[model samples]
Target: MEHSEHTEPRPPGLIGSVSGLVKTTLRLVMSRVELALAELSEVRDHLVKLAVLFALAILAAWFAIAFGTATLVFLVWETLGWKILLILAAVFAVLAFVLVKSAMKLIRGGFLGMPATLAEIKADRDMLL
Candidate 1:
């Protein structure tokens, strides 16, 4: 048999490889973006929960403070005379401030830093192929 030197055509060069890599990267990024969006949704939900809880806690605290202050004023007026009402009011005001400040700090440190987004993303990623 006669031998003929022939070479099959090879694939395209660097540009083809780069394009394939880019397409793969884009697919990965799209999947990741979808995951991040899902996470954002969960974060939004948690934010709503936090807002509602914070509002309820603040309202309850305010009611408690108001009732306590009224009781203190009434007691001071009856027992210690009207002069002590002002001192009682001042103490109540300080307590209210402290309570509000501490509550705000706790809310900020706990619910606000809950990382719902990160957790959701991780969970979703784990569920992925």
Candidate 2:
């Protein structure tokens, strides 16, 4: 009876393998960072647009509300007088508040980071551990 045992050859050196691994890991990190930057850029654009829209809306609403309130207060001054001014002021405050809250809602709708890339990095960390 004859028996044979075959073994694979040893790797040339450890440094080469380590260097290759490091390069690959760095490449992954760079790619993830790029993804994050792109995501941030998109989020920034959306936020900028939201900011501009809210600014215009707030300015226009304030002007219109102010003028309308002044007109109504003038008409009611002889009767209700100062009380009419207070009521108009309250109404204007409420509407302005609503406008601000709506803008906040829009701001909350988006995120400023690359969620997928972050998740991938977390997964990689776990795998390495």
Clashes of each: 0, 0
TM-score of each: 0.58, 0.75
Which 10 consecutive positions of candidate 1 have the poorest summed lDDT? 110-119
Expressed as tens digits, the lDDT of each residue in 1-129 for candidate 1 is 666688665696999889888998688768767866776677688789878987998899889877987777776677778767778768868987997898788767755453655675577678664
lDDT of 1: 0.75
RMSD (Å) of each candidate, 1 decimal? 8.2, 7.4
- Per residue, candidate 2 scores C-alpha lDDT tens digits across 62-129 of 79877887788889899997899788778778977997797678656656556777788898899989
Which segments of candidate 1 are over 4 A away from where they belong?
A: 1-12, 78-129
What do the candidate models score in CA lDDT, each in turn?
0.75, 0.81
Q: Measured by TM-score, how close is model 2 to the native structure?
A: 0.75
Shift of residue 20 alpha carbon in model 1, Å? 1.3
